[model samples]
Target chain A: MTVAVADVPAVPPDLLTVAHLSMRFGGLLAVDDLSFVARAGQITALIGPNGAGKTTVFNCITGFYRPTAGHIALERGDRSFDLDQLSGHRIARDAGVARTFQNIRLFPRMTVLENLLVAQHAKLMRASAFSLAGLLGLKGFREAEARAMSLAEDWLTRLGLVHVADRECGTLAYGIQRKIEIARAMCTEPCLLCLDEPAAGLNPRETAELSRLITSIRGEFGIGVLLIEHDMGLVMGISDRIVVLDHGACIAEGKPAEIRNNPAVIRAYLGEEDPRAGPGSTDAPGAGDGA
Target chain B: MALARAAPTVSSGVLRAAFGEALVAAGIAFMLALPLAGLRLPINPMDSVIFRPWWVVVAVATVFLGRLGLALWRARVAPSRRNGVPLLDRALAYILPWRRGIFVAFVLLVAILPLMPFADRRVIDLGAVVLIYVMLGWGLNIVVGLAGLLDLGYVAFYAVGAYSYTLLIIHLDLNFWAALPLAGAFAALFGVLLGFPVLRLRGDYLAIVTLGFGEMIRIILINWSSLTGGSEGITSIPTPTLFGLTFTAVPAPGETAFHQFFGIPFAGVHRIIFLYYLILALALLTHVFSMRIRRLPVGRAWEALREDEIAARALGLNPVMVKLSAFGLGAMFAGFAGAFFATRQGFINPSSFTFIESAIILAIVVLGGMGSQMGVILAALLLVLLPEVARDFAEFRMLLFGGAMVAVMVWRPRGLLAHREPTATLGDLSRGREPAP
Candidate 1:
């Protein structure tokens, strides 16, 4: 359900600017001088067939792997951070960049509440010497813990995981696990959330729920979301902008409708048609085939 | 209708699990009885098999109970057209009661141990020694067990505490009691300094650095003759005194200390008992302190860091501080144990604080179970006491010890005992509360 708030803040454009980013793995070029922009308060989809170097770019931006060449800057109001040189943790803490794994990376043995609390570890350290001094009803610590608990509970309720809050993260159902991962990432209060295939293993109903959740997060939190999804229906319905990639190079960039009809995207998806084949020759032999 | 169906299903599952356990018990009983099962008893002590007790009542009880347990389990597991049981429930039926029984057995043994006929002087002395290892095992547990950080140079701190008290008492002319706290302080200082360099290393690298550190201290003691007294060591170190009375054969001032004070015979055993009780109290104090720390915020952070360093950092926990605290606190315990050891022995040498000592302490913690206080104590006692009792089997003692350790680990890869979950909460020990972000 879309919230009817007329005075909603407009999403900022160019929240993340990638300038000539390239990553080489020895002799192989994973991403070749790729450049893109993720707008604020919007769902920007990065889609490609397998090996199009989408994840490589995500890794570069998240500080897991340093780029061989390029600069990634995050704009917050008038300030921007050159994220290329920062460490992975500093990227999360200082640059307000958080992400979820294609395969869930929740701490399996810890409780759901703990997973969310751990994301706020930095903020807690700043407030107290871990004195837990106010952990119970202590003014500062209690307020912080209460806030974290409320946020965690709010997200868990939205995702239909309220009953499983005390269970181990590892024991949750597969679909619920993905929602927890996303909630955990959000708990960090990131300026930009990058999800690597958030709907990869979800059922149709779960996928629909995910689509609604993403749009609402953007609208409610006013944070930029960069997602890589293979489900065409979910992508077309939710994404404000889409970037198509083929062989580690951008093929098309536009609104979903524009991208759907782009000639280059069609070619990448459907190889050249063999005139001799038959009526279905227009589908292009060996092109756009979903592996 | 649902209740009727669920009842049969649940009870049957319980019966099945009970049967499996009974079979295992029966097998164990048979093995124990094999020597006397109409087969010739191995009269020769050097028989291929190790010493086997011939307690008749225990043997009968093992057999009868084992059979009954197996029968009940089988009846419980017998299939019927009733309610469907969840997979987890079936597994739980088998595991929960088994562990509960182990807990009961351990408690009973500890409760009745003092009343046993073996409360003779030798047994009491052995108990005292076992208590010492319990302290050492607990100290090492904090470093390697709870923190999941391998510390191969742990004995270095022990050596520092011992040498500190010994040298100060002998050369500086300080009383034993006066030098104890100073010795602990000296060890803690070295622990902090070690934390600085090894901060960059973790896992295997951390273990290697700690190993090198222990050896470095040993080398310093061996090579630096003037300061440490080198190979000769500092001997004739004074034993602990009870107020003004010494444990020496010559007795204390004015009259025989015990005769004058308690109007009792002047027996050396009284002193031994006093020292034993003292160390036992100190060891118990260490145990309680460790448990308190484990429930604190610092303890939770240590577990978090052990589980996933990257995730812990993302949560705002500074790894440097977390790690330093673990090293410092763990070393502090070792320092206390070291001081107590120095006063007990009345002498100190580099030979006494070798790498082997470190290895034994670590082996006790790991072989018991990581992060378990009670498990570590049990392990320390079993490992130390068993070997001492098997002294007459000197030729095969080392082989049996190594073999037993390997077998136990293989059977329970996690450890002899493992906790189902962490015990501590953040607010208590980790830190006081702050507002969540």
Candidate 2:
């Protein structure tokens, strides 16, 4: 199912464009001259070994870290936001970029439904007139609250979490928690979804389900997905495009088949082995794929 | 005969362990009681120290017996753990199911207490004081309980409120009704002021800064003698009126006495009952506002921030604004209670706004369970009434209080009521298909 390079231009336009991104942590150049583009309505997987600056790229894109030198442009409608220039929360609030952490960062004590509702806080807050209307239980605020609840319910039902919707996030299993995190990010109604290591701790069956969920999210929401994953099987299975990174630089970029056969990508994963050794190596990639 | 022999072996092992544990506890108790109870220094240096060996003996004996009983109890309950739940927890489980009913009953009881035949002057006064603490606890619950900000100097805002009211009335000739909201606004302003510097701080560091701020306010009140009257305090501050009708036995010139306006016989109890109702109204307003806001977006944001600040930020919540609002609103309630405090006492002093008062209010919020309104009320009742009830133990009143607090912590470290009801539910709960948990 590999497509020719000439077919790329006919695909959707870029939703996120990262140009010459470099992040320096004192003596260590965590991300050096990294560049990639995630197109709208496409799944772009950033795959690399551990400490290959994949998450650094994510942090820069999500405004968690201000890159030492870079231009991160997020296109939405006619306006383009310079993400590196924005603060951590404004990136999500103004630029419509939502992300999940590598480690699940759900509101553990809060119920699953409340976690989703909290993500819609900004919208509901305005509709409630900062709580004056909510305090009064006015019709406008009630309608707004009902709307938010339905949105939360929609996501809960879609994720097959209706049964545990009332359960606290902390008490749920790891795979469920991961799915809830994605649902929570979707509640923000972002134009681009950034998932960091969504398949990190999932079993093969769970990873397969996650891959399907991510695919459906992109298809249904019509939003770009920027994924940072080490699960090569999941990535190779679902990614529309794959950008392979090593030593904070882009080693290769193409479709899954191209990346699978790319010699540099193999060396980056298998580490200095002969290129002809191929995918038959019994040894796991040093990237901690958890596969 | 064989069964009896096995029983003795098991009983002897248990007895030996219990005895050893009791001995250790008694030794520690002896050391602790040595300076506190065994010996006392003479007032005059020339006099020899007095010894109280019997006091130490009593302490050691009590410790030994207490430890022995505890060990035996553990030994007996360890095998059948089903019965090992604390008595208080068992009672709580039964009572918690009827929490809403209990709250209604509690409110109704307090409402009719002043009218009850058994209610005397002292009882009504105690009720007023408890209400003040209740209001303060609810206010601090927003900051410490909901927002997860430890504000050790909350009394600073209370002081600001008290001083704002007194100074407004004295200097500007303003009445209580007029000064009430203004006092709250001033305290909120101070809350925002304190919040600005501590926005970057969290946990223990935030607590230390707030503690300093509280002391700083008190010190400023003291040293600014020209305004606050130094440590001497301001006296004869005007009390609140029933819409211009003063609660006085004799009408002063143009003033109408409360009894005279109402055509009732003059009685001093009228004033006490009136003050009780005034504080009650203010506290009820605080409670209603808190209860309503708990389900609001801002309130959920506060809880979210408490649960995880980073997650809240990712959701586009401005931590600075949410925190400031918590501090401001919490301090505003403290301000209202402070104004009531000033009017109730008919005097204003820095000593009235002490660290101990702040500690007591914080304790009420924590012991009640953070962010639990009913918990605060129950905790306030326990804390305020316990000390008064144990007055017979005068010197040991605080000791009793400390012991009670320790016992509660041991049984329910998360507070008396830590369970949180979700702000909203979906599907089955909303549609009534399932009972609300």
Candidate 3:
């Protein structure tokens, strides 16, 4: 499961490559000619203003909506998946690309642990032998269930959700639920975790914690992290690279510093003649281009 | 004590509001009472035409006083409970912690009910009827509660089972034991058939489709006389034996009777009791099977799908397969119950598999607090026995049943036993704590 840097290219290798991906819905071009590479063991942030097709790009990458044209490929140590050719569930299951929704889609009625366990469904479902083994509590089923619980517990304890693990997921605070949603996605053991607006409704303190979480997700899990966030502080603080989009097209892609200085990103985000806001050099001072 | 600590101004406000509320309520009551009280519908309408304005005033006053009392009680009670959750909800929550114990005790009662001296022929028959509904409830619970599919045509599978068993026994000369599983399989096949086309539909649309499916089955059974016996229905289906031994006063030549083999005198009650136990066992099996799977991966996936299908897919659970399995398994259980029904009655008709039958079975699942086995049993007994107990007023029993259902819904909007026991837990958080440095 470990990917050694010495065994790969100097650029750290693009674990997920969205090459010329385009998506259209009826009369609307949701995403157009988007191309970006998220390296393994790195944090990549996709940032833009509203209706800039940030979510549409995530949807195309995660296979929720098939792109009108082009390829989204995920390359591991030796394995690869043409994500554009896969279905939504298969992208998560077979391609090992787990995603969380913009609105934090957790099974509200289920317990926190159950939500996490559900993410390990494919593993358990296989071990369940179509529920025959699981129903009878066979050795394999028990082991699979134990493994799922431990994984769930691991995420729960890490996210400070252990205290409310047995409580229904809907009752948790929004920030806590967001963390649970991330943890649930992690439980799937995804190779490239695509998070949609992880810091949407979070306050300053929670957003700070989310930055640390995203950094550690790359550091500890050694997996590529694609974060869709409006919180510039979160994005600029932790992101190794940033992809800027405007009107479904990629405007820029570079390190956080370069992305901040990119004129196209500033113009696209702050509007042409705002004059009041530029790409603030410091991290997330106020409503500016990166904000 | 907390209420006492509140300011005195609030009490004055409550007093004024109560009077205003009571006056409004009295006005509504007067309006409602006018038509009913002002008109007479006796056999001799001319002679019994009596309009007493004094009586109307007295009725309105009584209603007003009752409303005042209710308002006072509401003001006195805790606001927490007043927000739709009554003290009854807390009591129900308390009971939930000991649900396993309650379930065991309830099962024991059902197990021993047939052996009691008061278990007369009527009691045994009623027990069988309740058990049949209990089985159907558990079957439908899988489709409706766990999978969140509204299957209004569940009785189609029931009809499939009954007719399958009847036709098998008559044409193929198959025994009840041999035909039972076949009947279930046939129904399951039909379930898959229904599932494939309707997998794309959800909620109300799925319900409407299933309702049509049920009616279609009934109509087919009525028309296909050669195969299903049509409106005349199938009759004289052989009674299920105790391992090939019939419960008869005189055994068929070279065959042993149930009582004779047991060294007891042959009594028809033995057969009734046997049938009751049989259906009870089937119902218990259905409950156990459903319970066993709830903790498994498929079961978790089902509950997850019920909560949010998109999230379920994000986790890589196949919606179509999950839905199809639910439909097939749910229908299989219904088929088993239907087979048991045919055996118990020794006859069945298209009338038995009507839309009303589907409605009653569905009502059992909902009334039993969907997915709760104990709730289903309790609901089945109440629903099936209430009508029998109220046979003295046969026509009014349905009205009474509807009123009872509405009252329960108002009391427990989530169903009586809706406290969901989580399948996944990590023991106590305190117990799992590691020492902090």
Which of the two candidates, 2 or 3, achieves a greater TM-score against the reference? 2
When superposed on Cα atoms, how far off is each prediction in RMSD? 8.9, 2.9, 4.6
lDDT of 2 by residue, A86-195 (tens): 98788887798999999889988889989998999899999999888999999998898898888888887787788888899999999999999999999999999999
Model 3: residue A261 alpha-carbon error in angstroms: 0.7
TM-score of each: 0.73, 0.95, 0.90
For residues B214-295, what per-residue lDDT tens digits would candidate 2 score against the true structure?
A: 9999999999999999999899998789989999888789999999988999989999999999999999999999888888
Report i-RMS for every model. 6.4, 3.6, 2.3
Q: What is the C-alpha lDDT of each candidate?
A: 0.75, 0.89, 0.84
lDDT of 3 at A286: 34
Model 2: lDDT of residue B238: 83
Residues B17-72, model 3: lDDT tens digits: 99999999999979966665655556674676667787678869998999988887
lDDT of 3 at A12: 76
Candidate 1 structure quality by residue, lDDT tens digits, B1-437: 56448656446556556656766776676675655432444668677554445454466566667676656544556444236654544664567667658756764665445457766667766777777778888888877876778999999999988888788888798886788778878888888889989976888999999999999999899888998889778777776767866666666456346445666666767666766776776777777777765544566567777777766654445678888878877777777778778777767789988999899889889888888776787788879987986788765587668868888787667777665453422332224444233
State which candidate has the highest TM-score: 2
Q: How many backbone clashes does candidate 2 have?
A: 0
Q: Look at candidate 1 and tell me the lDDT of residue B217.
A: 94
**At residue A209, what lDDT does model 1 achieve?**
91
